[model samples]
Target: MSSFKREFTKLYNDSPANYIKAKRLEKAAELLQASDNRITDIALDCGFNDLANFTKSFRDKYNVTPSNYRLKSR
Candidate 1:
């Protein structure tokens, strides 16, 4: 697992967990912009099991809450 992590980090410049989280968040953002789904549904669809964690993660990445981000995109 460590070897795989090292190789992944070397190739992607980020940890596997971080990479996956980033991809998930990116997908969530795309969904937010392209669909009218509720934020909670989007969060779950993006693999986040808890809404608060999803909100914090999304805010950390985008510098805005999911609802705010969606509003801005519109």
Candidate 2:
């Protein structure tokens, strides 16, 4: 498992879990821009189970809250 982690990180330039989270956030961003889904629903659909955690992760990646991101994209 550790060897796989090392290899994954070396190849992707990011840890496995962090890379997955980044991909999820990218999907969430796409949904925010392309759909009228509620923020909570978007978060859950992207594999974020907790709203607060989702908000924080989204902010960390995009430098904006989900609500603010939706607002800005409109």
Candidate 3:
């Protein structure tokens, strides 16, 4: 597992966990823009089990909350 993590980080410049989190947030952003789903539901759909954590991660990545992002995107 450590070897795989090293290889993935070396190739992608980010750890596997970071990569997965980014992908999930990316998908959540897409869903926020494209769907009428509620924020909690979207978070769950994007593999975020906890809404608060998801919101924090999303905010950290985008510098805006999910609802704000959706509003701006639309």
Candidate 4:
């Protein structure tokens, strides 16, 4: 498992967990930009079980809240 994780990180330039989290956040950002779905729904749809954590992660990555991102995108 350790070897596989190292190789995955080497190939992807990210740890597996971080990669997945980034993908989820990217999806959430896309949804925020392209759809009118509620923030909670988008967070859940992106595989985030907790809305506050999702918002924090989103903010950390994008430097903005989901709602604000949607507003700016549109």
TM-score of each: 0.96, 0.94, 0.96, 0.95
The number of the candidate with the highest lDDT is 1
lDDT of 4 by residue, 1-74 (tens): 69999999999999999999999999999999888889999999999999999999999999999999999999
In model 3, residue pairs whose N, Cα or C atoms come closer than 3 Å (at least 3 residues apart or on different chains), thus clashing, are none
Stronger candidate by TM-score (1 vs 4): 1
**What do the candidate models score in CA lDDT, each in turn?**
0.98, 0.96, 0.97, 0.95
- State model 4's lDDT: 0.95
For model 4 the local lDDT of residue 43 reads 97
Clashing pairs in 1: none
Q: Candidate 1: where are CA atoms >4 Å away?
A: none
lDDT of 2 by residue, 35-57 (tens): 99898999999999999999999
Worst 10 residues of 4 by lDDT: 29-38
Better of 3 and 4 by lDDT: 3
| Clashing residue pairs in candidate 2 (N, C-alpha, C atoms within 3 angstroms) | none
User: Where does model 4 exceed 4 Å of error?
Assistant: none
User: Candidate 2 vs candidate 3: which has greater lDDT?
Assistant: 3
lDDT of 3 at 12: 100
